[model samples]
Target: MNGPALFYDKAAFRKAGLQPPATWKELRQAAAKPTGGRSYGLALSAVATEEGSWQYVPFLGSGGDLEQLDSAESVSALTYWTSLLHDGSA
Candidate 1:
């Protein structure tokens, strides 16, 4: 089956001279670059408890379990997201 897709702004990518990220690592690399001084590099929403949980699903899934968040995969996923915030990318 096909997975979900992230539709990026073609104009922003062109202005940034960046190609769409083919992997999570590539996304991390580009997440810190602003798009033409107009929009943020990335946008995330975790407004409240429910929404936060919903938004966290992907990161939790990357680690494999909702209960065991101490797993290496879980840590990696959280750390990656934290980096985005810390690096001012999101």
Candidate 2:
């Protein structure tokens, strides 16, 4: 089945001296570490369409609910995404 997944370059991680991230915070930190020279730490689908929304489901699923779009968890998820962009991690 098609799904959201993360792909990493083992060599890149080794070169950056990073272990695979185990948590959202870790992922955020790691995302910036290997970013440079036309490389990005994470690539997200931000297009305004179903494909874009699909790419976000997994992240939101971790702490947010579509049913409660205004809930704290939802806000947090969005905030996290914003942080990633702001920090040049995505």
Q: Write the per-residue lDDT of candidate 2 for residues 1-90, one digit (tens) a residue.
A: 339888888999999999998889899988999887788898888999877887776778677987887899998998898888888888
Which parts of model 1 are misplaced by more than 4 Å?
1-5, 35-38
Error of 2 at 75 (Å): 0.5
- Please provide TM-scores, in order, for all candidate models, with all chains considered together: 0.78, 0.89
Q: Give the Å shift of residue 33 in candidate 2.
A: 0.4
* Model 2 stretches with alpha carbons more than 4 Å out: none
- For each candidate, C-alpha RMSD in Å? 3.2, 1.6
Clash totals in order: 0, 0
lDDT of candidates 1 onward, in order: 0.71, 0.85
